[model samples]
Target: MNKPVNRHPFPGTPKRVGRVGAGRGFSAANSNTRISLPGRTLDVSAFAAPASHARPGNLGLNSDRLRAQMIQRLRNQGIQDERVLDAMMAVPRHVFVDEGLASRAYEDAALPIGQGQTISQPWVVARMISAMCENRVPVKVLEVGAGCGYQAAVLAQFVKEVHAVERIRGLYELARGHLRELKLQGRVRLSFGDGMLGLPNTAPFDAIVVAAAGIKIPQALLDQLAVGGRLIAPEGGAAQRLILIERTGPAAWHREELESVRFVPLRAGTQS
Candidate 1:
């Protein structure tokens, strides 16, 4: 994956927490490059690669030092699941952010991605995945927020199939292009519509992750989950935290508190 050069000449605390909801369509300026390990470059182009793009090294995509810094940042943020850590380490984050900010791809904070939306922090991505997984590698997964497709990429590693639903058209295509370049077109499928409505056709998901927090877990999502499926998400605003929902018996379910977290509020209806 591409490594970000960190220049902390002057540092300031994060101004805020939480995600910006998936509202309407928005455009993203994609300036992506391939990622690499130590000295080897990994080609990350998927369906999103643009023919007009420059060679990644010229675009600042890969470097041993940058990759290490990214791994360190995720580690410091407490992303400890070995599988998740490895996946996060292997996938290129720069491909999912604005090209101008690709250099900061591995930072432990969220960044804007137009459309009043933001790509989630890497740690947050790991945490939600780890929580729903229950220490087991996943099989089939459903992701409610496909912003930039970063989180979906993370889930695609362990799971057999990841059906990610995004509410906005532009972001959906943005993620689709990026995932394609990553060669993940076969592993991750992007659906553009009301995520709150859930993907009924592909229901019975082994694991469900809602990247955007909601006042309450949507009934549609719950109904779609397979028995024993796990759903993890942030459940409140101002005082957000992670909740794990598990399917027990037919129409029976259980809930567990996993961790405190903040994400954009889940919205209803569809975008035009």
Candidate 2:
């Protein structure tokens, strides 16, 4: 394995808020973003204007219906955190995907986002955040599989800070741009690297979320979690399960199964 790229400060300040403020909307700043996900650049801020009810973003999906459907799906799947629910609903999901796919953004399936990765659906995102803490502990969080940065943005409302890692270049740049569009880039930092190794500088995270699934939880992530910090991830390959692990002692951790989950595999390595 190679040394991972560190999570650097946002390329520039508001003096340079990337694609969103400039109106290009997440276009590559220096060069074209090279995300490893299996999709193309999202056509953001170009969809037909949304109806009056949900006027902020015109990404096709009705905001209320999307929120309700997500909540219902989560409840059926056993996600029960009001804070998480509110945050999930508050963040516009349609804005996260390409305009072409905006109509299906609220669906339960994970869709492709360039490279070989898919942004885990809203339900899964909410489930992971809800599973992190039952009560409002309000601690720092470690997020893997930055994907399109939607999950990290969802985590920002409930947690103090979110340190997220993305292995793909295009997706990473797009995610950073997404955060800035939502004014969340300040709350969440993006690391262009492998999710398997985890972000160590912001280690001992009060909560850890592996947006991508692996055969088992990555051991390095376990070692980096703060005691009492809850790590929620979808583990296993063919038969994936959402596992919740809590650090009990300096090196001891407790595990519990939440539910069955399927997610993109947590891939290894970083951009060269």
Candidate 3:
């Protein structure tokens, strides 16, 4: 496997704040501190979630009704994994997007989330997650390019734990705030680092999902998968196709090509 050119710092250990309640907003207790990465120091306060922004207010849409409608559309599209469907239904998609676009949150379309990234369309998210959960429920999962943390939130509903990494500092902090607002920080660990590296400290994940397209799957990611684990990512440029890789044995892997899809090119290193 090839090594990453640069290594970024991970966030400081999360401290326990007060209990999080529904519709109630809370910030990290250590939000005011600073975390020192290998070559950079970041002000943790920038990642804090304010009470006002924690829970989105009335966005001119009936959240539950719209979510139900979206699930119906998924069913129509052949998303058979009941677990994935249930999870998609449970999470309020609007909260992860800007208020201006909240009305269209339930639509099967990808919306911009700043920083040149989009919260993936509902169908693609459901499809990728369903493919991972087809055979068995993954105990530990890693999500690369966790834009706004929407997919990780949905994955957390059925999986034991989800470790998500984002290379863009803005998106990483955005994801942190959103997950914190949903009170899912405990189940989903958000890391601000290079997604190509694949979180070595928490390696051998049962399943992995990459949100962007790459010329080829990162070798580091392949090595991180445990035996019997599976990874889903988009490969190729311009004409991209979703590929599923299964770690069949210690040194062997099986690859299958699935539906064609489009996504932003996956890049290396983090950006401020």
Candidate 4:
């Protein structure tokens, strides 16, 4: 992971929230230096290594301190799950965003990462992950819309395995590289495919999280949820609601709506 030495300081108050719906009214938007903790660095040729690797010991401490602050903010904002907070603290979010935007990575707001896509707000990510894991740690989790793999990486911290699907080729490759660089590739697997059609071959996931909003919950995803499993996603048109569906039995499911949210539309098929 590379530290931003000359980057602008993080804003005291976030100016905008993450990706908002078009018709909806809303505000629009780590690893040791040269040290590889989780996985190998991307082909160094594609992306240059940081100019400076000899960062002061305080740099890592600063990141830790910032994460702790984020955790506190999340707690005050209603993220009560300690497990989710811990995972947020562990994952170096900066690694998942472009180097230029690394400075704002810790902010609660969302930032663009090319392809007109944006990472979800930290609060949203924490809230969703917390809700999905409220009962217990899931053995296998499926994540739709991997967007740079930030959400999936967070889920990986608390789950046995995470299989994230992304429809865009650019994002899928970026996410794959990010996860690999973080050495979390083992816990998270990224695939370039249509997310609307959930991975059936690996059906019956303990939990499923969709980062994009759809007019209605995709039946393919619902069918893949294991008995007693939970699926959380933003659904509805014009107005979106964060919904949680728990498969209670072979043929029954209980659904509950959490908070109102805005996310990019979930699309079908893959793009190169």
Candidate 5:
């Protein structure tokens, strides 16, 4: 859980706004909250303690063993990237979810995180990140539909910087709080804006991962991708498939379809 201190200052205002096809364009509002590290460190002894010492009815709620088991499940499900697995294991999923749902955090299931959005299933997160990093470890990354900030936090483990945008104000705030609690505000920058538009000011990302599914990939996102970079998103309506787009040159791009997925529809504009 130890992270390097960010030497550089946070980036400035979001510059570009992506077009959402028939919908209007929207800008991102960056979170300016100062970084604050927690005074108390998390006690992880429970995770290392032997199972024989476990108390009755204690389902290893805070145990690292649960995370290890989750990682094993991801491997069995076809997640091969060791970096992705380690990153997922490093993050505590329960921290980004609701208290009531904490017990089920490592269950490989998507759980509600308020505002009609759910923290994505663990497998999907690992898959998208694994795909994005397959070619090269991206230095800068953008994440659309950054619900609860879990994916972005996980991305931070593999990427140098992460810029995440969320349209819903409540989820935006919720994500901000969760990231701060995890002391990841430096590595992951959370923004309140339309995710469909993508963060233009920080354009030309080495990799872009969209959490929600759109009927078609947004052009603005495609344009913002750096040359040789890749963008992975879910595309379709009624039924959806994971789409991976690689920017080969200034005017040339390549698209490939992989595994079917279900995600909240990608929307334009911001929610109050």
Candidate 6:
């Protein structure tokens, strides 16, 4: 396996703030940013727009009712975290998919979002988020494979900031547009870069969630995790299992294997 790419710093003086509660607690920086990272900087401000709460037109199914059913099914499937359930309820999964497939958005299945990528199933997203937050609600989170940005949006509601990276340009732009329309671009920063090379400049993340399955956990991602941070990803092939890795100490981590799962391969580098 190849080494993950090195990440540069956010283009400004980023204060090292610890965990913070939800609500309007996270705010964007307005002043000029300082350039610290080596590669190109992703200007989150470019994707900024006020999120809209307007209801969509009838699309053969009632979104609210379907979303409710999805949440209930998640509950039945053992998703006990109330915050995770609420976030799933709050986000309109249909808005993250193509118009043709919007009707089946809440069917508890993964839908393709072009570029050979698929939005993660609701159950998996909830389970992963719940596990990562099992110890504590993270203040800063990193998401590998931004897909339609649905997971990032869901996570943004629970965490302070979300750094979502996507290796495919098409998927990255698609996610960026969806997130921008949902007005979640503020809290979810989208990047079109390699996923294996976890963003190092934004190191010591409170939580890291990988949407795709890898042969093994990337050491670079583990190195970037804070002491008390948690990282969850689908590991193994042919017989894949969800693995939860918690950074217990500076050089120590505790690993736990959860339920079985099937996910797209986690590829390295960018596809522009």
Arranged by lDDT, best first: 3, 5, 6, 4, 1, 2
- TM-score for each candidate, following the candidate numbering: 0.75, 0.72, 0.78, 0.77, 0.77, 0.77
Alpha-carbon lDDT, every model: 0.63, 0.61, 0.69, 0.65, 0.66, 0.66
**lDDT by residue for model 5 (56-149), tens:** 2334655588899999998866677788888999998877766666778788665654434356668767777777767477899998867567
Clashes of each: 16, 13, 0, 2, 3, 4
Comparing 1 and 5 on lDDT, the stronger one? 5
Instruction: Find the 10 residues in a row with the least total lDDT in model 4.
Output: 26-35
Task: Report the C-alpha lDDT of model 1 over 181-221, residue by residue, as the tens digit.
Answer: 89998999888878777789888888888755666777778
Residue range 97-127, candidate 3, lDDT tens digits: 7776778889877665544345667777777
Q: Compose the digit string of candidate 4's lDDT tens values, residues 30-65.
A: 010110112321100001112221212333557777
- Candidate 4 accuracy as lDDT: 0.65
What TM-score number comes out for model 6?
A: 0.77
Clashing pairs in 4: 38-183, 39-183
Better of 3 and 6 by TM-score: 3
lDDT of 4 at 51: 21
In model 4, the number of clashes is 2
Candidate 2 on 143-241: residue-level lDDT in tens? 776757787888787678889887667667777778888899889988887677777777878888765456667788887788878887766667655
Q: What lDDT would candidate 2 get against the real structure?
A: 0.61
Q: Pick by TM-score: which candidate is best?
A: 3
